[model samples]
Target: MVENINIRVANLQENYLIAKHLYLMWQDIGVPDESIQSNWLEITKEYIDNARHKLFYQAFIADISNTIVGSVSCKIFAGLYPNIIKPEYRKQGYIWGVYVEPDYRRQGIAKKLMEEAIAYLKSISCTKVILHASPQGKPLYSHLGFDENNEMGLDLS
Candidate 1:
């Protein structure tokens, strides 16, 4: 539990920082450098911009005395199937790009960011929040009340 850390919503101009953090997150998850696009930052920024404008996308950052140390992004979940359910019961929020500076790990910054995201989703009447958690993030997310989802994946390579 780190003291004096500030968690706040990210501003529009800070999308690039959020994008960079996402790229770093990929690397941290052992994505080969060659597997990521060279222009990943631009692509991610574009996605964030579009999502922000259209899908209620929001991002949060953790700062320690004015220096950013972590970030998380969330938005309305674009479902894979056709949606017929009412918004009040089936509206889902998605969370992604959760990252923390290596030096700041284990200090509760990530938990704070997650709690903030969950609050935002709840405020919008989201019935559930979803994320594909990396192995490293599973414990923290589990502790935050997230449950195992019904999603399945297959290797297409």
Candidate 2:
């Protein structure tokens, strides 16, 4: 078993790997393929690029035993309706895409990543943070002070 883990800002070298892993995980969890292929692709690329260009926002990676096991990304979306978040690193604050390897669940990797994400967001003067959690992630997010939102969405496409 891995003894220790590290969390830090993701670099360009790690972006593709993290994005691919997230794509697979999201697919396995039944994220609609079309959405994953299109929306997520754009969002991931934007986050990766933003992480490279912008210091105010970043994507954090979690590594265990020197292997990247999970990640949490946060960015800003300007001019979106108070609750409408942008997927292209345009949110006014941080929106995370946090995932932990299945085998590593319950080990607190995600939690640590989240804590780091929040700290980073605060450092950049973020007033709020948000994430869309799966059923499995709901408990962890709730434990971290996230609450359910009573919002509705309509696909204009």
Candidate 3:
């Protein structure tokens, strides 16, 4: 059946489902190993819940048949690079947790969710929008004006 899928702002009420989807996405990206499954689930839940309260922007969820099949969130922060570099801080946002069900792939769902995230970030006066895109999503983000940059990472363990 061709059902109507609606993309709307995710509320705190949907935190669990959102967290579940995020956990699945992380597994899909090879970031969460089998040994970390339980720990990661708790971490994802707590983080998703906290972002709902702390972030200035909203998370978007695409619901089809009352199931959240796609999700994306933008984080907006008012600060310079690390905020210690300069006192004059501008707003920045990031698109994250972008996922669509396997069966729902290539159906323009991810594009729609990303459009929502971009629009929301822009509405919040975000000067930049960043995301660590998966290989499958790189082309989509590139087509939408996101480019590759030499990004560095640090592991604080």
* Predicted structure with the largest lDDT when compared to the true one: 1
Best by TM-score: 1
Each prediction's Cα lDDT score?
0.94, 0.74, 0.78
> lDDT tens digits, residues 23-46, model 1?
999999999999999999889999
Give the candidates in order of lDDT, highest first: 1, 3, 2
Better of 2 and 3 by TM-score: 3
Which residue segments of model 1 deviate by more than 4 Å? none
Give the alpha carbon lDDT tens digit for every residue of 1-157 in model 2.
Answer: 3459999888867777667767876876787887755666668777667655763657788887688888877765343456554343433465556787788878898889889988877777666776777788889889999989875789997
Backbone clashes, each candidate: 0, 5, 0
Determine the C-alpha RMSD for candidate 2 after optimal superposition of all C-alphas.
5.1
Question: Order of all candidates by TM-score, from best down to worst?
Answer: 1, 3, 2
Candidate 2's displacement at residue 79, Å, is 4.7
